[model samples]
Target: MTESTPALPQRPWRQRYHVAAIGWTLLLAVLLVLSSLMTGANFGTFLSNIDQFLALLVQMSHPAWSYLHVILQPLYETIQMAVLGTTIGAVLAVPFALLAASNLVGNRLLRGLIRFFLDLVRTLPDLLLAAIFVAIFGIGSTAGVITLAIFSFGMVSKLFYEVIETIDMGPLEALKSVGATKVTIIWYAVLPQILNQFVSYFLYTLEINVRASTVLGYLGAGGIGVYLQRSLGEFNYSATAVIILATLVVVLVIDGISNHLRRVLL
Candidate 1:
């Protein structure tokens, strides 16, 4: 007869861990219920309001095609603002990003300071920035451009430095051993490896700025947003729909270009 093997016993720790997980899950469920109650999130109210929401949606369903001709100029201006802002921000971010890269900058304090400044810039709301710029620059696309540039700088710098940190250190060390200056090493060793990634990030930032520029116009910074606000104020949902559709088309075109460029770069 063949010998039969005994079944292995379950460990006490495993049972305890399973029980702990159940307890934590129950606690989380209780917290979720309590929070929902505290926040007054009533599903019944939403259900009651659904008809009104659908009515508004029905109104927006028919876009005003004739309004498109009128908005073409403002739409072009919005694209221009996004392009100018993204370009300025991306160019200015390069040196700061290099400084913020922990591998590139040996001094921890300097990197910390640079990172802190980036954080400060990122904390400023874009709408508030637009408002401030409008006050200073006096209601034009220039204010929109400046606002977008600052916003893009904060975002792109963080992304660039993170990309820099992930780069292979082998090239850097190789350059350093050959008696190269810091700038020379960066130019030859660092730029080549991360160039594709940088371009991809820049394009991504540009895409975002295009969307942001629309809202900036609400602050009198100049874009189709001014028309959007006017249409909404005048209760002209058809024109508002046309503006939204136009903005969507611009976003889609930018996205397509960005995808094509990324494929080519890769």
Candidate 2:
């Protein structure tokens, strides 16, 4: 009897992946070197600046607690700005998101156009939007509110559409089979599925807007960021430290609230 030829073992697909990964790694290393040379990103400069950075840290170690009282009004204004902006943006995003969702609209051209416009709107940075609004509205919370509204609109619209797309189609189909009107179908079927996600995203956006409004104030858009900018410009590290700590506390509180609400909703 002829000896049976040993069956050759098949190489795992992961072996091929390893070979391709090595090639990509080398390519990325070469590109990184070229980029570093082109950009003059010297590690030595960063090392030298470490001392200066440490000195500033030392100066800010003791925050100016007295300034906290003074910043209360601006802090309140910042919260107000975030609330107003998020409310306006979320309301506006609802209709746009519904229209942009392919599952909801069923019009490929319209959905594509709306998504394209949303993408365009998102590409404009918040700071740039705030600057433009400041120019138009002539400084104050009004410009900040408008900027935050637009920014929140662009972000929430994308998120809301994604949620709409991921929702169970069974309920929607059932509603349609019942010969329900579009409004009734949305109210009874679509809204229930997406409402929780909508609230979750709205709160998340509110958290972001609170932080962003601070920076917007630097551009004369109105909030604590104005004070933050001024303190930094004047080299008042202690006051800046206070602002940073206060902002950090606010962010943590907002995050905690968001987490609680998400748990309840989920």
Candidate 3:
């Protein structure tokens, strides 16, 4: 019998990466040049404005402590709007997410339709939505709350469906084999796997809603943003500084709570 020769080792796929790297570098260079030209942006303009920006910074350094007490009511209203909106949105997202999830919803057409609708909703800017609601509701926190709720719904629905898609199929299959109802399977099998992610996203959305609500007040939807607009209009830099600090505190607190919850859940 003839002796068989051993097979030679395969070469690594290295040349393709070098080609890709060169292509990406060229693309980035072209994009940067095009963007700079389009926007008329230059390093010189930025340098010239730097001193004036620092002057404004110096003016805002001394915060107006007396304005703090006056802001408390509006600040509380902002928090309330965020909380109510997030809760309402999270609750509403549950059904939409289930419908949009490909694994959960067997019908491709239905899933596609649901996703399309979700995309439509998400496309509407939060500020525009708030303005519309403000027009309809005639101002106050109601417009802000509804606008935030809708925004959260669109955002959380997308997040929830993505979480559902990423979950392990094993438990889902087992639950199905045991003849559990769809709702029961979701509660016992699906929710456990993705509950933490859901909560995390919810908290993240809450943080965003808080920031958005502040802006919504600019449209007279009602929130701390109304005062923010007034302060800026009046050039009350000290009061603006106070508002900025207070907003920073709220954001940090929410971030801390989100991190703690994620750690415990995970």
Candidate 4:
């Protein structure tokens, strides 16, 4: 026993716990627990209420196929509104993106101002904008179009400028050495590199607007969502299921088209 006790176990200093990481992890866990409590997110409550959710899901699973014909036109209108709004926004974003790009616009003050304006535009929620526009434009597709256009503008401009900033500087410098005008240099150097990416972003925004237009329709902005509201108000879960399924199909098609366009363009 004395001989065995002579060699004590060596401390593994190299394998010691990281105090800072442990402290941070514990702090994060405490915050999550506090947040869950404040939000009334107890597992017991969820378990008690789960039956109602399951019943609703079961009702929604059996869709009213006959309702499809009635919703087709409104679905078409939603797609039309998305296309118009996204086109308008994509076109308008070009100039703003050019002005905002650090590489393109060397003026720090100007870039800051443009970025600030864009931030302001993006700060407002699209639903709030739709409500405001609905009031002004009298609750029609006009309000929806304007709302989608402004929303698309904010998103596309930010994306476009980020793409522009990543482009090769060589062409830009080459054009400058030949004394090319700003427009000429952008046309020859910048546009060629970023145009395909711009098209890709445009299609992406269009896809999103297609879904958003349906939500905007809730405010009487004119789309399938108007019918969706009515179906829910009447508690016709079958019809509601039909609407949801149709919307999902539309979104899937948009995704396919966007991918095809990206491949062809790029």
Number of the top-ranking candidate, with lDDT as the measure: 1
Instruction: Name model 4 segments beyond 4 Å from true.
Output: 1-17
lDDT tens per residue, model 1, 120-232 = 99999889999999999998899999999999999999999999999999988998998999989999999998999999999999999999998898989999888988898
lDDT of 1 at 56: 77
Off by over 4 Å in 1: 1-39
Ranked by lDDT from best down, the candidates are 1, 2, 4, 3
Worst 10 residues of 4 by lDDT: 1-10
lDDT of each: 0.93, 0.92, 0.90, 0.92
Q: Which stretch of 10 consecutive residues in model 2 shows the poorest summed lDDT?
A: 10-19
Q: Sort every candidate by TM-score, greatest first.
A: 2, 4, 1, 3
TM-score, each model?
0.85, 0.90, 0.81, 0.87
Best by TM-score: 2
**Candidate 3 Cα deviation (angstroms), residue 148:** 1.3
Residue by residue across 1-266, what tens digits does model 4's lDDT show?
34555767775654366666788899999999999989988899888999988888888999999999999999999999999999998899999999999998989999999999999999988788998999999978888889999999999999999999999999999999999999999999999999899999999899889989888888888888889989988988889999999999999999899989988988
How many clashes would you count in candidate 2? Answer: 0
- Model 1: lDDT to the true structure: 0.93
List, residue by residue over 1-266, the lDDT tens digit for candidate 3.
Answer: 99889888765666646777888999999999999999999999989999988887887998998999888899889989999999999999989998999888999999999999999999999999988999999978999999999999999999999999998999989999989999999999999998888988898898888888877888888889889889989989999999888878877887788778777876
For model 1, give the RMSD to the true fold.
3.5
Candidate 3 weakest lDDT stretch, 10 residues: 9-18
